[model samples]
Target: MARWKVNLAVLCIGQFLVMSGMTMITPFLPLYIQEMGVTDPHHIALWSGFIFAGNFVTSFFFQPLWGRLSDRYGRKVMLLRSSFGMAVVMTLMGFAHDPTQLLLLRILNGVISGFMPAAVALISTNTPREKSGFAMGMLQSGGVAGSILGPFIGGLMAEWLGFRSIFYVTGALLFGASMVALFLVKEKFDLAEAKKKTNITIVEGFRVLMKVKQLPALYGVTFVIQFSMLAAMPLIPLFVQDLHGKGELLAFYAGLVGSVTGFSNMIASPLLGRWSDRIGSVKILAVCLIGAGLCYIPQALVTNIWQLFAARFMLGVFMGGMLPSVQTLIRSYTPNGMESRSYGFNSSALSLGNMMGPIIGGALSGWVSIRGIFIMSCIMLLGNALWVRRTLSDPQLPKQTIQKAGSASHSGDDT
Candidate 1:
């Protein structure tokens, strides 16, 4: 296997473990808050949204800061730090006695959620540019796979081992990931150059970030993709309950449906990414967004759990191309030496979307059937398709221009 592939595998495994563990809390959160003595549905909804969005709020602001710091300090070190920080916070989350405590810990988790971004930056810089889409897609697949597996595992652990135990397990898994990165992930840094150059500040990076014309489109896509993706999350379990009620089949099939989506993401992500490498990110994104929109319509119409699962699986397949494509496009445009900083901005956009998705989903669920969220999601994705179509330029055009320029120069008299 190639070095990039090996690196991707290692990183993916770590991501799978970490995300699976962390996300275990999702299914049980509202119930946990209720158990903690918050009885009112409104209160539960409010607190749940707070806890859910807390990490993203902090992470959105903190990501760029961490990214720039990583650029100055080193990606490996930043990954190690974030992993360790997450381990400690997750363990503390298991021990929280109230919704307030859990919410605070979640915020702390967001503040330190840059491990994946750092890993992404490291891998992106190391891999050949032509192959970056595949590498990024592989990494994303690992996380999506974890997300797919997480709800099932989390539900089982919550039932069998207790919700508190899930936190401990999550903490331990993160700790193990940190250790693996510390010992196995190697990146040699230039101390001499580091000493000679001044580190780029967050404000400076933001200034440079604003100057990049491509950044807006990237940020817009980031927000839109996340909004579309996360809009589906809060409703998955609810939709299952609505379809099948509080039965063993509901829980079992819910897990199965969610897992199927992950399986699809795992399979489709790399293929789509590799496809993007050939076809270009803009076209792939446009197709994915439009396809995802159409797929959601069937989801809204489904009466059976199996139908919902099938729709979700299709949604996963279409959505799989999104992250890797965005990352590749960002990598293509980011100036040299500011890789982490640029990715930081990208991470912040994703975090913002993460924060927005659930709140919007939860609110929408109150107004419309759980399936209505799918309708809303479909609209969002269609909007994304339109937005991307309008803003995203063809990456291939520059290469064609370069080839044309070279041909013209060669045809002329030798200079």
Candidate 2:
């Protein structure tokens, strides 16, 4: 296999492990807090939201700094740095005895954790331009698969070994992933060239990148996608309860509600990526935004759990295309030697969206009703789609594809 393909495969595994380790705590986070001696139900809920958002909060601020480092030092070292740091923090969470300790540790994890963005930067910068769409699609598929499986695995491990022990196992798995990357992935980085840009401040980096007309719009697309998707997701359980009733199996039904979307997204991402390689990602992105936005309406209107399930499945199909398209477009627009920094800033936008989405959804859900919150999300996404269509530039064909087209035209003339 080519070196870029090898790196892609390595980073796909790395992304899977990173996503799994992060999400394993999701199923038992509140329960773990209760076990750690938070007795009041209200406090448990408040503390849970706070601790959960803690990671994204710090991540939102720190991604640019890491991106700049990755550009200067090499993406491989940044990958190692993040994986090891997150591994240690995840292990320490196993020993946390109180909510404050857990909260603090989660906050710290956010500060140190950034394997995905760096992996993305590595792959995007190193892979052939024609293959960026496929690489991103496959990587997203790997991460989604991990997200689908992680909760199930964590739940089983928590049942058999207890909640705290799951953290130890998660830590070990992350460490193993770092080891794999440290040995297998290859990057043809120029240390001399990289060092020349080392002194550019993050602000300066942003200034330079923003001069690319399409970049800010692409950044907004990244943020809006996350914001619109996540804002609706945290409310799925409550909406499921409304449609299905609060049976003992309600949580099971809600889990299905969420996982089915991921399942379908995994199916759709690569297909869309292939299509993007031919027709252009910007077109696919606008279509995906519109399709995903339309899919949200049925969720708000569903009268039963089955209806909701079908709606979410359709939503996933469109959702899969959104992120890979945005990532591909970002790479297409970014200048050479600054790819990592652009990805880093985009990651920050994504993290900010992640941090704010749930908070706004939670805060507004009761006032506007869950259904209303869903409507608001739908409007935001559709509006974003319009903004994307109106503002972003037309996609340029990949150089290889253009060369092939020119060759075919000359052959036709000769015939």
Candidate 3:
């Protein structure tokens, strides 16, 4: 098999295993906190917030650092470290006797869960330029699949073996994936290039970020894009229950809904990527944002589960293109030699969005109706579309450049 394919396989397996562990915790976490002998509603709410937000809070700080480290050290080493660290943190969460302990562990887990960006950097660095869009789309789809699967499996396992077992299982899977990474994954890092690094400080990453003109627009678009996309996530299970009516398999149904979105991502991601190659990433992303905006409106109107599913599916299709386009755009924006660190900044944008999205979604859901959240999501997406149209350049490669780049691919080595 080609090196790119091998890398994809490795990433996909690891993503699935890790995601399965994560999903197992998502739905049951509140219950787990409650079971920890917490009786007060306010305390439970605060504890829940700490549990969920803890990892993201630390991750937001650590993600860029990890990205830079991956660039300086090796993405492979970072990947292994993240996987192993997640295993330890997750396992510890299983053993926590109180909500406080769990909260601390979650925070620790956040600092360690920097693996995703590292994996992305690894694959993006290795991918042939001609196939970057497709490759990125594929890798992201793997993550989506894991998100889809996590909640369902987590719910089932939590019920069957108890909440604590879910953590144990999740830890084992991640630990096993770490072992796979250490033994099976091989990478060639540039010692001369990495070693020749000048006196670049960690603070300098912020300066580098400020100096990149297009990066601000990219960051803005990313924030709005994820805000729009994840604005519905916090309400999904509730929506499912409302539309379908509660059942013995409520969590499973919720998982099914989540998985359906991943299913759509799997179907649409590659098509969007290949299409982006032909027409340009910017145009496709523009259309996707517009379509996604429109799709959210239908969700506000849907009364039944099937309609909700259709709306989510359409939203997924549009979203599938968004990240790949952003990744391709980041590559286009950064100097070729700085691809690793440039990607680190891009990853930071994504991590920030991920951290903020659920918080905003939850607050919106609390303040307004779930239907109102969809309207807000539409506005956010449309706003991003307009912003991108005005500020960002089209991502189309020049014809001569495409021909030269494509010809070079035939000789091997994208760089």
Candidate 4:
């Protein structure tokens, strides 16, 4: 296999481990908080959202910093750094004596989080442009598979052992992933070239990127997708409970309902990714946005857990195409040597969405109903789909123009 292919495989495993470790505790966060001595339901809900949002809040600011650093120091090093740091933080989370400690640790985890984005940057920078869509799609499946399995495994482990043990397991998995990255992933970073370009600041980098007409719009898609997808998450368990009428196995059933979409996403992402490579990423993205928006309608109307699962499964099929297509478009629009920074900015956009989505969902749920949040999410996605259609419809810029701009910007003093 080609070196890029090898890197892709390593990244896929790394992404899987990172995502799994991150999500393993999600299904049981409230229970864990309770274990830490919180008795009030309102307090538990507040802390849960705080701890969960804390990670993305820090991540939104730090991702660009890490991305810029990756451009200079190499993406592989950043990947290892993030994974190892996360391992340590997760292990500490297992030992936290209170919700405050866990909350702080979660914030710390966010501060060091960039493993998946680094992996994406590495693959995007290394893979041949023609194969980028397929590669990104395949890479996305790793995260999806991890997400699908993580909560299920966490739920089982919570039943068998406890929530603290899940953290230990998650930490160990991250450590293992870091070791794998150290041994297996390779990069051809030009340190001298990077050193020569150290004068360019992050602000300048953003300005340069925004000069590209398609890039800002692509970043908007990133935010919209994450925001819309996550808007349904905070309410899923409650919805499951509503559907199932409360049982001892409520957590398990809720976990199943939560993971069903990931199962379909893992199956569909690579296929849609490859198809997008032949047909057009933008076209696929537009279709997926519309399709997923439509799927959310049925989810809002579902009468049982099975119906909700079926709706989510269909939503997954549409959503599987969304991120890969967005990433592919990002890869296309990014200038040659700024891949990491571009992906980093995109990651920040994603983090912002992650931070805001659940809050919006929670707020919307309180104001109207859980079903109303689904409808709201549906509207956002459909609106974004139309925005994408309008914004990305211009004729492609000539390759020579992009190459010229890339060369000038990367030559060390041109910020």
Candidate 5:
């Protein structure tokens, strides 16, 4: 394999471990909170949302900081920081005596959550511009695959080894990932020049990056994509229960309902990513947005679990195209030395969406029901597609305008 491909392959595994370790507690978070002595049903619901969103809320603010540092120093160091930091926090979660302590640790997890962004920065900087879409899609696929398995493994472990033990297992997995990255990932960064150019104030950096007129729109697209997808996620188990409540089949169907989308997303990401490389990411992004929007309509109307499965599978296929396309577009629009920072902002947009989507969706479910949330997601996504059609006129920048993901130093473009 080529050097870039090798780097990509390593980072792909890191993304998988990072996502799996983080999500390994997903299926039983509420139960874990209950175990921590919050007995009321209402408290369990509230604490679950709090614990889940806290990391994202902190992540929304902190990811850009890591991005800036990665651009200044090197991407690999930041990846190590995130992986090790999260490993520590994951293990600590296993020891929490109460929801308060667990929530605080979750917030700390968000503080160090830049493994994917750092990985993306590293890959985008090194790979040929034409191949960025494929790299990103592959990385996303790896992460989604982990997410699909994490819950299943967590459930089984919760039965055999208990919930806290699973946290320890997650920690070990993350530590293993960090060791892989430390040994395997290589970069050709110029440290002295990177430090020299890294003096721009955070305010100045933000201002300079915003000068790329196309970026803000792309960030919005990223936000809507995550928000639309995740906002509906928390409601799925309830909807599955509504569809088929056959005791053991109920749990199985609910897990299947969620996992199938990710499974299809894993299948579609690389395929759509390769396609995006040829035709430009904007067209793929727009069509996928519209397709995803339409796919949700069937989901909103599905009376049977099988109908929901078909719609979700199709939705995943469309969703597979959205993020990689957006990331590619962001790379295309970003200034050379500023690529990592731009990605940071993009990740921040994603974090914000991740934090707010569930809160709003959960709130919406109270008034409109689960079906209504689906309809709402459909409308928001189609509206975003229209916005993309009107607002984004991609600079049509030439493929030859490749910039290394280093600092303002252009002398080391030898990679």
Candidate 6:
């Protein structure tokens, strides 16, 4: 295998382990908080949100820092650092005796959380430009697969071994993933080049990226996609109940409805990614955005559980194409030698979206109807598709516009 291919394979497994480890707590987070002695329902909900948000809150600020370090040192080292740091934090969570301890550990986990992004930076920088879409798509599948399986595995473990054991298992998996990255991932980083760029502040880096015409728009797309997708998440179970009229197996049905999209997404990501390589990432992105946006309309209007499920599954298929295409576009536009920092900033945008999406969804579901949230999501996506269509049509926009912008900025700096 080629070195890039080998790196891809190793990173895939590492990404899977890291993602699964992160998500394993999702299935039973409230229960874990209760075990830590938070008995009030209101407090449980509050603590749950706080603990969950804690990671992303810290990660949003820290990702760029890690990305910059990755640029200076190497993506592999950043990956190892994140994996090992996460492993330690997760293991400590298993020993937490109180909500405060758990919350602090969760915050620490956020501070250390960059494994997947670092892996992305590594793969994006290392892969041949021609194969970037396929590599990123295959890489995405690993994370999706991990996310799909993590809840199931965590639920089973919680039943058999208890919640604390789930933390231990997750920690062990992360440690093993770090070991794989340490032994297998290879990089041809130009240390001299990295050294030269090290003095550039993160603010300066963003200024450089912001001058690129397409990058800000692409970041907006990331936020919109995540925001639209998640805006319906907090209401899905309630929607399922509304459709199915509630039963003892309501939770099961809701879980199934949720998993269908992930299943379809996992199946479609690599296929569409390869397709994007053959066609163009921007074209695939536009098509998928429109497709997914339309799919949400059916979901909003669905009269039955099966209809809703089908719509969500179809949405997942289009969504599978979305992120990889975005990543491909980011790669195409970013100047060489800055891939990691650029991706890091993109990751921060993604994390911000993740943090905001559910909140927006929750607020919308509260203020309006659940179905209305779906409609809102659909509108956002369709509008975003239009934005993408207009902004990203010319592939040369970045190269031409950014060069002029950079020269002008340099002149200003000189003056």
User: What C-alpha lDDT do the candidate models reach, one value each?
Assistant: 0.78, 0.83, 0.76, 0.84, 0.84, 0.85
Pick out the ten consecutive residues of candidate 6 with the lowest summed lDDT. Answer: 406-415
Model 3: worst 10 consecutive residues (lDDT sum): 397-406
Residue-level lDDT of model 5, residues 87-114, one tens digit each, is 8999999999999999999999999899
Q: Which 10 consecutive residues of model 2 have the lowest summed lDDT? A: 397-406
lDDT winner between 1 and 5, please give it: 5
Please give, for residues 351-377, the per-residue lDDT of candidate 2 as tens digits.
888877877888888788778877887
> lDDT by residue for model 6 over 177-276, one digit each (tens)?
7887788889889887676545466776788788777888888888888888787887899889999996688888899998999999989999999999
Model 3, span 253-347: residue lDDT tens: 77677667678877798899888888878899899989988998999999888888888888889889988788777777654334565666666
Q: After superposition, how far is residue 59 of candidate 3 from its true place, in Å?
A: 0.6
Model 4's lDDT to the true fold? Answer: 0.84
Candidate 1 vs candidate 3: the TM-score winner is 3
Better of 1 and 6 by TM-score: 6
Per-residue lDDT for 91-183 in model 4, tens only?
999999999999999999999999878899888878887788889999999988887777668888999988888888888888887897798
TM-score of each: 0.84, 0.92, 0.86, 0.90, 0.91, 0.95
Stretches > 4 Å off in candidate 5: 245-248, 398-415
Better of 3 and 6 by lDDT: 6
Minimal lDDT window, size 10, model 1: 397-406
> Which is the better candidate, 1 or 4, if ranked by lDDT?
4
Clash totals in order: 0, 0, 2, 0, 0, 0
Write the number of the candidate with greater TM-score, choosing between 1 and 5: 5
For model 4, give the 10-residue run with minimal summed lDDT.
398-407
